[model samples]
Target chain A: MKAFPAIAIASGKGGTGKTTVAIHLAALLAAQGRAVQYLDCDVEEPNGHLFLKPKMERSESVGIPVPVVDAAQCTSCGKCAEVCEFNAIAMLKKPLVFPELCHGCGACALVCPVGAIRETSRAIGVVETGRTGTIGFAQGRLNVGEPMAPPLIRAVKARRNPDAIALFDSPPGTSCPVVATVRDADLVVLVTEPTPFGLHDLALAVDTFRPMGKPMGVVVNRADDDRRVQDYCQAENLPVLAELPDDRRVAETYARGELVFDRLPEWRDRFDALWSRIEECL
Target chain B: MKVVITSSNKTLADPIDMHFGRAKFFILADTETGKAVVHDNAQNLHAAQGAGIQSAETVAKLGAEVVITGSVGPKAYKALQAAGIKIALLEAVCPGTEALRRFKDKELPVLDKPNSEGHWV
Candidate 1:
């Protein structure tokens, strides 16, 4: 059996249509009788399932512990605060923790000489698995006001099937979330608009991916039937795999939570070509 | 008088770290009056796997007298103090860059004591 190809769709900035492209790509692959696993790693604001609408089959919670100091064991020595790297512990006279700043590494307990710190799990998000026809879907839903997302993203990726084409829908920005989603990708397809802001963020995304040593290509979402995006791609040596012009049909289809490939048969050919290029590179 | 933040490699600017190690980076800023340098190493270097002990040593080598950063788990803190590196625990900020910049500007509110947790969110 051939190895399943894993492709991640990411954008440096939000609102550039990463999920929109991911949905169509999954549909395109499933149309070709290939089993695909669609993972929504944007735990902060997962929206891929909004379009795919897979049926939930399994769900699990992802949690990280926020250490609680046993004041009885605490000698007011300020040792816990002394060893913490995140500044989560505040030990001027009494040691306290700021939950939002905690990464739950449990280093404080290990470092504490008195062993005053004990860990309790804090629920950060939920990973849900569902199925839509032949496509398997998974998504991480982050709790409101949680600062961390990478841990939950990694949790979703860990559940990915080795034999299914993993189509990852990454969160926006070139920060930790995007890095978590794209780090192990076989190929990264950056979907961006044709404006200055789009190009600016696209450059940042390219820089983020450059370190991973992965093959990347750009898919111009709403190419505007213009040359601005094309010129930038040409100058940057980035291959423009597909030009999705600004079309009301695509927009209308997307707004109704419908897959673009289902509405437009011709676009499936373009998606297939992009997939083939990525496969060849791998 | 140079400020050096050393990760395992020289790539601290990436913002998104893959290492999740005990050390993220050791930020070393030169002191004008004192002969010592100021620095802080990331708490759990392996969790983020970002920076390591080498980064802290680099900061110490730069002659930093004081170091301002988030947490420094006990083992690393002892080593830094043994090297005569004064430690200051910085107030946690969501964007670590802003917290680091405040330290450079001498505007960061720092705690004279160490923190009680491992991860810096």
Candidate 2:
């Protein structure tokens, strides 16, 4: 068995082709006879499933334990409220727990003097696993109105297969959810375009991931659209792994839930080269 | 009956604050004695989340039977309602004392549902 390297595809700004690059790379790798696992860590709105078209095998609910107060045992001491940093718990003659605002740190339960506070798991999302040919596919779907995504993202990442290459499709921006997706990845591919917004957010993502001491490379989608991305990469001494052309066909195919490698056979070589460059960085 | 009104300033002549959760002060006044006490709500003004819930808890702890404000979010409305606090909407910006007078004279309308969306503050 070969040691599988986990690579995370992330972007600073949304719609920068993170999913487009991830699914293509995963498909190309699996086509090369290597076992691969594709995990969509964008729990807020997972879309990789649309392209992968994996069979719906099974799903497991994910949740965090929120404190529930027993009114009969509660003395209205206000200690639970005082210990809550998120202000999720409040005592107004009785303890009231706002589950929406809770981070599920369980501090309130620990501080309850009367042992009135107990934790109850509230479902926030679900992790679904299936297969697209030989490629393992998993994604997290956060329930509507649920504010938290890190817990579900963690659940998705926990399904990582050490026996195969793991490719993670992280959510946009440099928030906590993105961190949860790319934290321990072997290599992080920062996808960007040749635009001011892309460069600005790319810099923010670099600032966030660089401090973690992880090796990173940039992929400039719609490469011929602008030269600024290449110029920025050169100035920053970052490796340019792949440059995808700005083709309307690629966009149209993606919109129709199709893979670039499948629609355009010529691009399979390009994704194969992208994987090699990522290997060099690792 | 004790009434609480969100205010921008501590004085009775100050304008009623349009925001409920982020208001500077909550004036707790007695309808019969006309005695008003100002409770500073500066701590919750800078809260990143759940300011409305904390603000609702503050007034409920102060033993206010009624609340008068320009707008109320769902979380605060739920908390106030659970605390058995009657909510009255001012509809327009007016002096804090005027809002109290309207409440006493039955000119203000009771709010059964939240007027503004959550996180409005």
Candidate 3:
């Protein structure tokens, strides 16, 4: 099999089975005696751990630099506020910083004339690593109320093992976080259902990834339920890698936080064949 | 003294906007001269976040002595208070000029604390 350094499984709409496809593919590859590492880049609401069941070995805090003010050395010139593109800082009588709004781009600190502005780290999320059997796993969990997720997603992706076949489970939607996860992947597998909403968002996801000049394939989940996704993929000249039929057993196993392969071992051969189809695309 | 009123349009006859930060325009009315000018608030209207704080900064920069609006968020209220700008809360939706008239008549109550939570904008 050809080596795919990183494969990002993304969907424009949520609950289209991004995690399910990602975990099953990784588990199948690991079962084939191939080294596989799964990185769940859905920092806002990562759930791959539920199925992979990795025993978390260690976790670390992720932070972004926010501006800090030195009133003693300060002149309230309002330069920091003027430089802030996010309106995270205000200088009414004194410099006031809204850390939540800050993107931590360090524009304020860079523009501060009197050296009154300094950067301080504020934790936005956490990254955890562990293993599920032979498969390596890592996931990012964004802190509640945190507006940004791209930074933490980047942190999670940075932990990817180059030697292993890294599979990234991306966040839904064609947003910044999704772009951050899929940007560096060798191949992008777009997952979608057979409904109008699915096709609409899948088109959006294609528009987003098409500009990046990366090879992409489509995986229609609940394959027999809807024909629109298949029609759309055929019209777009995108390969339909594998079509897993709508199965009650798959859904039930997923609800119980169990891998489909664990309950129906026969599905392992299907996932393995799915990898073969993905390899044919490359 | 200069007073700022959140408005849905440039004219004083327009209804006072319910949201302070996302208001379409801010009417800077001079109580002494009975004259008013409109400041466009398009930037903050579509701001991803911190719209309230940005609007408050605009009010402070305009050197307004008071702000008359339907509702003010906690962040904007605090910023306005720090700038020594009094907040006058409107009990009902009405024209910008009528809100100003209510303020002048002392019929509108002063906001001692924020009446709305942050991100209400």
Candidate 4:
């Protein structure tokens, strides 16, 4: 299947400014009269909405199918418990179902002899959709203490506006949730800093996405006197799309939940150039 | 009354497995009949998640009225409580016979809540 035209703004480490780049790009594109949708796939702790501040027009709970055993029809066959790979099901004097441990694979239901096991939707998280202005917006919010995030991330993607360009603000790290968000992206803008930790984690992020065969570019956030990040990008043959110099005003503006382009007109040009470079790379 | 003690080995002389969910063996001791059987817990020992909950069920299925372990997580504590099995805390790595003696003597501290957080972060 042909994947959607989406750009995932990802960082290997947290607070390296993946959402910083994502919201700016969305704002820049929307102001330019380009149809754009800001989809925050960082369900664990989505911050794009803090800046976009979308007026929520719709919100819905996302759920996964969990097995609900019917004891009356069960013949103590233990098929449900035996077929469960996660040990979510246990047959004692009676069958015990652990919904939290269940991955909702429905293997037990498939193996049930008298169809005693039925699947039921158990809410895990929520996906909200709305718009701030010309920019359509969506973000996934995983329930507190929920072990999984991919399902909520997928829920946000499924809520993407098909008519607009998708800018996915992904969660940090190259884990399952990150992979789920960026796997189908047409282009990925990897944001990073210039510190040793940033450089090392950037390489880890690059290694992670390189195998997926998706084209990627680097955007150095809080760029400073350190040249390691630039040198690493050059050596890896990856394009440095844009670099935002370290500025105290940028951090202050971010802390106040305001967009950099709005509060600081001087920074608008930087994001403008970033959008152009991203378009060429895409 | 039957009590399940987490064991690293089948014999009573072996050290108790500190980890409850992933314990190598569950020593199910019947205080009334003076009989105890060691059940293999390799399945829950290597479970992807919720090993504690599954282990609680394992002991409950073995007709245990009490689960004696080193420490218990929230899920396992709840599961054991729901099954009408009282959870008692004893320091892990001691001899299973020692735990059995404590269980029989009613000298172990009963867990009011989970001793540790879940394995998942």
Q: State which candidate has the highest TM-score.
A: 2
Query: What TM-score would each prediction reach against the true structure?
Result: 0.68, 0.95, 0.93, 0.90
Which residue pairs show collisions in model 2?
none
Candidate 4 residues A187-257, lDDT tens each?
98999999999999999999999999989999999998999999999999999999999999999999999
Model 2, span B4-119: residue lDDT tens = 99999998899999888888999999999999999999999999888998999999989999999989898888888778898998889999989989999999999999888887
lDDT of each: 0.71, 0.90, 0.89, 0.88
User: Chain B TM-score of all predictions, in order?
Assistant: 0.47, 0.96, 0.95, 0.93
Pairs in steric clash, model 3: none
Of 1 and 2, the candidate ahead on lDDT is 2
Q: With candidate 3 superimposed using the best TM-score fit, by how many Å does residue A5's alpha carbon deviate from the native?
A: 0.8
Clashes of 1: 41
- Using lDDT as the measure, the top candidate is 2
TM-score leaderboard ranking = 2, 3, 4, 1
DockQ of 4: 0.57
Two-way lDDT contest, 2 vs 3, winner: 2
Better of 3 and 4 by DockQ: 3
Candidate that beats the other on TM-score, 2 or 4, i.e. the better one: 2
What local lDDT score does residue A174 receive in model 1, on the 0 to 100 scale? 90
Show model 2 residue runs off by greater than 4 Å: none
The list of candidate 4 runs beyond 4 A from truth reads A1-4, B1-3, B29-43, B60-66, B78-94, B105-117
Cα shift from native, residue A250, model 2 (Å): 2.0
Error of 2 at A135 (Å): 0.4
Better of 3 and 4 by lDDT: 3
lDDT tens per residue, model 2, A197-226: 999999999999998887899999987757
What lDDT score goes with residue A52 in model 3?
Answer: 88
